[model samples]
Target: MCAQGTYITCANSPGQNFTGCACGQCAPPGCDGCVVHLAGGSTLRG
Candidate 1:
């Protein structure tokens, strides 16, 4: 699971797993969606 204030995207395909903590405000290429942990204590799906 991703830690608070972070996001993650993964797949069965090779090299698709990525963590947003390593790239703030940037989503991995080909990523269709992600779960973002907000500072307001809520999760947003995009």
Candidate 2:
């Protein structure tokens, strides 16, 4: 998480799960296909 608006925020995401967009599997519409793949599970395509 070092891109412009896409920065890492532990405060925002307390769970810190790799399932969220912060890690991988981006949301639909405005944001998609941006993954980090910290561990398990691959990325999801929009």
Candidate 3:
């Protein structure tokens, strides 16, 4: 399970079983989505 202020991501593959964590809080209110910073200074919205 993800921590309270962390986000999770996976590569574009089926059954690859890879998990990654991004440092940020899940979107507030419902906390149903996440926003994270990418390596190239971009933001990923999900």
Candidate 4:
């Protein structure tokens, strides 16, 4: 797993990156974080 506060490069799109553990989710360009819905019905930063 990626450590918290680490920089993750977005795979779905080029030239995009985010701060924090994304769990493999891609963040949009220029976004520091992205919102993701969990299977348990909770929202968190991905």
TM-scores of the candidates are 0.36, 0.19, 0.28, 0.30
TM-score of 1: 0.36
- Give the number of the best model, judged by TM-score: 1
> Which pairs clash (backbone N, Cα, C closer than 3 Å) in model 1?
none
Q: Report the C-alpha displacement of residue 40, candidate 4, in angstroms.
A: 34
State the local distance difference test value for candidate 1.
0.52
Q: Candidate 4 lDDT (Cα, whole model)? A: 0.49
Q: State the weakest 10-residue window (summed lDDT) of model 3.
A: 10-19
lDDT of 3: 0.40
Model 3 lDDT per residue over 4-25, tens place = 3343333332233223344243
Q: Model 4: clashing residue pairs? A: 22-46
List the lowest-lDDT window of 10 residues for candidate 2: 2-11
lDDT of 4 by residue, 1-46 (tens): 5443455543454565455445445554554435543445455655
Each candidate's lDDT (Cα)?
0.52, 0.35, 0.40, 0.49
- Tell me which of candidates 1 and 4 scores higher on lDDT: 1
Please provide the root mean square deviation of candidate 3 (C-alpha atoms, Å): 11.8
Decide which is better by TM-score, 1 or 4. Answer: 1
Looking at model 3, residue 29 earns an lDDT score of 35
Clash list (residue pairs), candidate 3: none
